[model samples]
Target: MIEVTDHDGVAILSLNHGPVNALDLEILTELPTALARVADARAVVLTGEGRCFSAGVDLKRVIDGGAGYVQEFLPALSTAAFAWFTHPKPTVAAVNGHALAGGCVLGAAADVTLMSGGTIGLTELGAGVPFPTVPLEIMRYACAAVSSLVLTAKTIGLAEAVSIGLVDQAVIPEELMSTALKHARKLAAVPADVYALSKKQLQQPAVQRIETLREQDDPGVTEIWGSPATRDFLAEFMRSLGRK
Candidate 1:
């Protein structure tokens, strides 16, 4: 799931489930807890092991586990995403590789997102799923081209991602962590109370929308994700990718 290490006063949280680090229930459940454990740190940096920030949800698991899984996973997804988005300390995403669908949302949720050699975008629609309320709202708050990215379900290169505000900076792969730490440390230098207050103020509207609409919206999103048609589509989509 997640590996936590302390670098000076900054807590660096690495996604340790290798082979693309696809989001699953356990990973999602552990994420917020990991953030909570490191709450006293001045800042946090999130990155993935290997060449992926994440490839997004594990559709194979979804299709295999069926609706029962979707019911549990959806809430965990929202919880983890909301926690990442609202973390009081300075948060930085060191996106080292592909960040698609949920992965993109996780990166964007951070106060500062920096990437190296990855493509990033919202591709959930391509998988025949609608965005859940929290993820949709976070993208709306963080990305300048949320509508285009979500609708098209298309991933763009680092340069375009930076230009469009999907990420704040594009660093070389070798320098990704260092650059992320630099940004994190700079933000960490701000007075904690002041920084937390400003972040909360800036994010209040999106946070409000998430709180107000999630109970209303997630059920329908979960229903679609659990539908037979969606399951069939996901099965075919996985086959097309040469996955099981």
Candidate 2:
């Protein structure tokens, strides 16, 4: 579900699942492995293959697979997200298109997030799922208006996203990759050890919070996700999208 390529010294990790690049068990399970493969690269740029960064979790799969699937998927989600968030290399998110819910959290996990031509936000509440600890913490760390976005579950366009600190910059689609690479290269130029150390220090607070509360919070979140009401909501939500 991830395609890795090199641009100069930077590694570009592209999300290449379905059309919207929805997060599923296979993608979540493989994401950390992909990150590990690029560990030695000077920096990394994350983007999507098509017109979407990601549309978030695979709700159809969740609805079909039921609670048993959720038991496995939730932990995998946390593991993959934590891997991306804590990666030692400089990371940039080239959000080429829509990034909602978990996708938004993944983009925000990067050191810098830049978007072009798509809406982005946390839509978990609208989907009738609670945010797992890792993603919730990352959103709080990256976004200036986390509460409003999470509570409302409303998406905003690129310009508004930038204004609210949901994204650092907005560029045209053509400039998205180039701009992301430019930022990645700049960050790559910094001494690796110093950059990694500084990044760790900067991220420590969020990391600590995630580590501390995940055990307590994730079980409840998982329970809600697997609850019958959530399944019903997901079924209706998927139906609204004309998805089976």
Candidate 3:
């Protein structure tokens, strides 16, 4: 589900699941380990191999009672994303295509981001579930790029996404990888300790926000995830998938 290749001192991690790169328990469980292997590199670039970066967790997996398949699911996902967010090395999300829900969060979690100008959405409202608890640090970064999304159920196009600060740059699809690597190399050239310290300073306030919310979010998250309304919404959302 996760594949990694190192180029010079840069580590490139690609999402490899088939058909839209839908994230599932397998990917969720193993991604952290893969990320750990390359966490010490000078830089990291995360991109998907196919048409979409990811469509978030596989709906079918959840609908078919695959929930228990991941005993530590949500925590693992939150942790994996955090690992990327706090990586000592710079991390860039190379968005080649659509990135909805979890995929969108993954893109926003990066230290820097580049996109090919495609669809990106946080369609949790459409699915009738509570939005992900959104670590305060992640929310600040993601909001710059996609704040309007939190206000309503909508899919963000590339230009609008960039205008709002959801993505740093949008390039032609074919140039996405090269663009990402170019920036990654530039970031890699920064003095290690200096760069890491600057990055940490930028993220500290957000991290504090996340810690605060984590304590207050349990009630809301539990209600949303376990609600009958959410279950019904999930079913309908799956059935309506291609009609969009």
Candidate 4:
């Protein structure tokens, strides 16, 4: 579920699993692999096909696999996202549509985020799952008023995303790709080594905090995922969406 295309010196990473591009095994595990393939590229543009950048984690997988699936999946997800968040190049998120929960975290982790008149939010608290630590750090770094918002798992529209700094730009749907490409080209002009090293330095605090939280909290998160309450809550969420 990842598609890569090269243009000039930029790599376009398109999420292509399905209509919503829900975060799943392949998308999580394959994303850094996609980044590796584009190591020579000057910049990267991450986006999605169909109606969403991503709808979040695959609920069906949670329902089907229970604690066993989550134990491995959660760590892998954190690992892959950590790799991308610290990718040593200019990267931009071209948010074409809805980016909920984990998808919202991905957008926030990027160097810059552009939204195509879509909604973005963190809804994990309401969904009865422990928000993973790395993504939580990404959100706090990107969004203003995040302390209150995270507690509520607030979802915001495009205007709010821009206002709160979750999105750097909000473009009309038709212009999203063009605008993102423009940013990619502009960013690619920066010396790669300087950009990479400086970025690491600038974000070192958040990065360090994320690492600490990942180490200290992943087991607890995994345990919560395995809880009967989480299962019931997740099952209810599926039923609410009429997913069976």
Candidate 5:
């Protein structure tokens, strides 16, 4: 679910789930430990090993008691991402492909995001599920970087990602990793403690909002997961995907 490699104070974290790299219980469960292991690195690059960066949380998981499976889930995943967001070191996202939902949020949370021309941010609004509040907060901060592209979702192109500020650099698919690593190395030179603290201060307001939402609304997860509207949305989404 997660793979980590380190080189000269730099770390690469790859999401390696099969196919679309959708966030699932295993990935969510294991991610925090992975983040912890390389938390001391001067820089980190997050990428995925597949055609899609991540298709977001598995809809099937949600329909089939995902609420139970992930009852302890979002907080863990959010905590890990928050670590990345405020890490003293710089972080880069080498978006290899489509970064929908959770995947998009993860990329945006990075200090700098680089995308292959094919990368896109899809919120899954069509699915009828409420957007995760944590990601929305992340997106709020990312607006300067990738708002227009995120807004268009499917219409996003590599140039669009850069123009909207979602990605610091956009490159050909084959060059994505090299570009990300190069950028990460440059960022590694920043004064770590200062950079980290600065990032924390810059992000405190958004983080606080996320915390409040989680605290107040998380208890409703079970009810929302079982609601008639949720069921109808999932069914329609499944049907659209031919999963029905």
Candidate 6:
């Protein structure tokens, strides 16, 4: 689930769902509501508990849930991504560990990302899963180098992630939260109405583009998630994991 804690005026939303914090329908559906609750907070920090920020979606869940779940899931997922990008208050992602696929997208979607001690990248290509509009736009809006993630599926280390601007700050594990809080407090100091208006103005184009692309791209990708070809690929990937 989601844990909301207040730090001064900043709200930290920590996802703690089993090991690796694999994102599931539960978190996807709850995230927007969480953001709504923190609307008055000066700023927000999103992170995950345990060893990894998230290993991405719960793959087994996806393989088992089939098309019906994808239909219900993508909308909620996209909405959460949009919320991260356009939250009236500034947001930061304190990446505690490996963030891949959807997890990486979550970090990239934030206003500032502070990652600590692990690899983070989009590995969607190898999984035969496609990116939805909002995640793609978040990456594009955040950094230009992320354009290559769609074409490759490799995990990048802390230096590489920072060099590519996927992460704004890199720190030792102990320093992660303090560093994130420092930035959060800095942004939170901005007057609420002024911060909201400027953040909206800055994000409007990207948000609008995400909405535009959602109408055209989300359906096709959801169809692919349920398509026979993708299912076969997922099955083979599952078998490979079993062998490991």
Best model per lDDT: 1
Best by TM-score: 1
Off by over 4 Å in 6: 242-244
Task: Decide which is better by lDDT, 4 or 6.
Answer: 6
The local lDDT score (0 to 100) that residue 219 gets in candidate 6 is: 86
lDDT of 3 by residue, 151-237 (tens): 575888999888888888998988988888999999989998999999989888777777778657755665666555666778888
10 residues in a row with least lDDT, candidate 2: 235-244
Clashing pairs in 2: none
lDDT of each: 0.94, 0.93, 0.78, 0.86, 0.75, 0.87
Each prediction's TM-score against the native?
A: 0.98, 0.97, 0.92, 0.96, 0.88, 0.96
Ranking by lDDT: 1, 2, 6, 4, 3, 5
- Comparing 2 with 5 on lDDT, the higher-scoring candidate is 2
User: lDDT (0-100) at residue 116 of candidate 2?
Assistant: 88
Put down candidate 5 lDDT per residue, 152-220, tens digits, no spaces: 445466787687777778778879888888888898777888787888898889888988887676556
After TM-score superposition, the amount by which residue 203's alpha carbon in candidate 6 deviates from its true location, in angstroms, is 1.5
Residue 116 in model 1: lDDT: 90
Model 4 lDDT tens row, 57-140: 997887788889898788778877787788998999999999998898888888999998668888888788877788788777
Residue-by-residue lDDT tens digits, candidate 6, 111-227? 889998889888888889988898888888887887687778788999999998889988899999999999999887888889889988888888888767789898899999877
Clashes of each: 0, 0, 3, 0, 4, 0
Please give, for residues 1-244, the per-residue lDDT of candidate 2 as tens digits.
Answer: 8999998779999999999999999999999999999999999999999989999999988999999999999999999998999899999999999998889999989999999888898999988899999999988888879999999999999889989988999988889999999999999899999999999999999999998999999999999999899999998887786853
Give the clashing pairs for model 4: none
State how far residue 184 of model 3 sits from its true place (Å): 0.4
Question: Please, what are the lDDT tens digits per residue for candidate 1 over residues 1-244?
Answer: 7999999999999998869999999999999999999999999999999989999999988999899999999999999999999999999999999998999999999999999987888989988999999999999999879999999999899999988988899898889999999999999999999999999999999999988999899899999999999999998888877853
Q: What is the Å distance of residue 230 in model 4 from its true position?
A: 0.7
Decoy 3 TM-score against native = 0.92
Whichever of 2 and 4 has more TM-score, that candidate is: 2
lDDT of 1 at 85: 94
